[model samples]
Target: METKRFYQQRLDEWVEESRKQAYKGRVAEYIPGLAAAPQHALGIALWGTDGQFFQSGDTDLHFTMQSISKVFSLLLALMDSGEKSVFQKVGMEPTGDDFNSILKLELVDPGKPFNPFINAGAIVIASLIQGDGPDEKSERLLQFIRHLAHDNRLDYNEAVYESERETAHRNRSIAYYLKDNGVLEDDVEETLEVYFRQCSIVVNCKQLAHMALVLASDGVDPVTKQQVIPRRYVQIAKSFMVTCGMYNASGEFAIEVGLPAKSGVSGGILSVVPGKWGIGIIGPALNSKGNSVAGVQLLRHLSQDWDWSIF
Candidate 1:
């Protein structure tokens, strides 16, 4: 790995170059709160397992986790229900369709979700989380995230949560479909509440990087040297991050950046370079596939320049 000074200077220059990509995309507007984000803002934070940190551009800007939350929720579900049970409810394959598409749920027999990273699959994973009800489940998931980020202050953006709940008609339909297919064992509304709240958890780039660091270390907290999550579960989550985390663009990202990553509609991306660094990025402008345009470009630049790709 390069020195911190080297990364800092390159990141400073690269961020500005990447920010130019923002104009080619647009902020997500389906959720009213997300629509209010600054469209051109871009930021990145990288945390190394060796305790080096580098940040540049709009690193202080906060954003919700959105679909990135699905990665953790899937981990939690696996921890709660184990691999066999979780796989029974969701398949291991990625759907080439849009992240929220309901086409496969109807066309596929047995009706299990194609994978846990998509909205329908994540809703089913939310139901699998162990809790007394929606509130407990949401709280448990939140606490788990806080633990990963090592920031107990982490909490949901209530405005975003309410906005998502208000505008989640399609998600509701997906949940109902999953329930009808017997893939979801919990009440549809309650399960959705958990999913919505998880998606709304707010954090800046540095904090997001911290959370990614845990995953990069295979669920160990590098600072504390503690095994916070089981290694097997982390392996499973990272595999999904590779295969389905970028929605329909996973294969392109694999070839381009070659790191396991998860992207959110909020324009946040959590990515990990195995055994080295964990990265977090935020750029409000999104491509058609719902990934951060500037953020992806920035990662590609860094990966190519620094040879960070796992492949």
Candidate 2:
């Protein structure tokens, strides 16, 4: 096992080597707040189940969770509604389409979302969260995230939330379509509000890494040794992460990096070297399929150098 000193010595060199790939991608612009991010910025943090920690580059830089929030929301939904109820709203299989594509919702029988990591499925999962209204639901989800991250101060980036809410025509359309198809039980706008707020939750790489660490330990907090989430739900979440987390590039990532991971449009990725480390990365530049270009490169390098691939 590599010591913390060894990681600290080499992490910066690895990060800079990976930063060069940022030139090949661009920041997401559909959301005004996200477009303002530095296109070349790259950062990473790693937290080990054995209590080792290492970080490099823009690790302190804060960004919205974007689609990465879907992972936690899915977990919370499973806890609230159980596997049977949650699966009734979203499928376990990946769609291979763009994360926001609604084509399958129209053509697929039952008209349900293919998986929770996608926008449509995430919206459906949001409705499954137990609460009397959107505000309560959003708060409950945020509290769950805070608990997983072990940080009580974590909260929303309201600017990003408003920006997403204003420009989310496609998401709005998908929600309404699901409503018409008998898939959505809550009010369209209310469920969408919860989904938007969850995506807008602000977090740094370190905080994200901590959250991933819980999953790496099978829903246990390494420091406290407490079961933060049920093991079965963590297994379910990790399976989805492997198959559908990186938008349409999940298969490629699974083959190359071989770790369960989730990526967000804000250029954040939460990945796990199961039973070992939880990794968080932020590189605002995105490839055509909406994943962090430099972040993925960095993970590829580390996975190869350290043989971190679970496969």
Candidate 3:
């Protein structure tokens, strides 16, 4: 309980400190919906293996998951298609380019994506989720995320989804390229629909923390003690999160935070301190690498303070 009290006190101090970092970054404006968030806002929630839940600062603010959905979608793809099948469509290494870059597909031999977390790779994985159509796949992915969060009310932000769909010229090009290369399992538009809808799934820090707790426990629900995803698949997802989850800034984050963390362009990050805690953070202002500037700094401070490094 002393540790809990200490965490409470430190979180308040850290949140105030981190909030200042947000002013240095810009809110993502590629999609019209994301540009509407308050730039200086920062929030965080933590769910401990010991059943302690603590939250501070703007924790109730809702935002889309954005690229963070790739983690869960990759897990669902593995569950549906198995590792061999999933790996066949996407490579395991990280691409040093931007998450949506298409140049690597032409230069990187065999033409598969460098990893599942990137946009090109995620689109292929989206096609692998078993469904009769885009709507069904989107529903299945949402249900899986809801099951993890233990909140059936979780759903997509239609306005965001529509905005993403409308402005997805680069994503559309990637899908078409994948289709031309014969990597997509379904129609290009359909697969992109699933990808866009998943990215639009709205979440707050509390729900994100609960969902991340499943990954922290290695696919087991900490509260229910049930295996929600196979251990091996969770291992794969976490590995990807470590190496590629922060987009081009993953190596820097790994060196500083030293935990498996996936960040979204919407300024949301889902981090796992394996067997100890699940953390969720949101700060609408983003750094150049499409990650939350304030949220990333806060994680660095927490990781150093708690000595949570996996390395």
TM per candidate = 0.98, 0.98, 0.99
**List of clashing residue pairs for candidate 3:** none
lDDT of each: 0.94, 0.94, 0.94
So what's the TM-score on candidate 1?
A: 0.98
Instruction: Give residue 211's lDDT in candidate 2 (0 to 100).
Output: 97
Candidate 2: Cα lDDT at 199? 95
**Tens digit of lDDT per residue, candidate 1, span 1-311?**
45767878899999999999999999999999899999999999999998888899999999999999999999999889899999989999999999999999999865789999999999999999999999999999999999889899899999999999999999999999888878887898999999999999999999999999999999999988999889999999999999999999999999999999999999999999999899999999999999999999999998999999988
Candidate 3 per-residue C-alpha lDDT over 179-198 given as tens digits, one digit per residue, 9 for 90 to 100: 88888758999899999999
User: Higher TM-score: candidate 2 or 3?
Assistant: 3
Q: For candidate 2, write residues 199-249 as lDDT tens digits.
A: 999999999999999999999988789898999999999999999999999
Off by over 4 Å in 2: 1-3
At residue 241, give the lDDT of candidate 1. Answer: 95
Best by TM-score: 3
Worst ten in a row by lDDT for model 3? 105-114
Off by over 4 Å in 1: none
Where does candidate 1 have its weakest 10-residue lDDT segment? 1-10
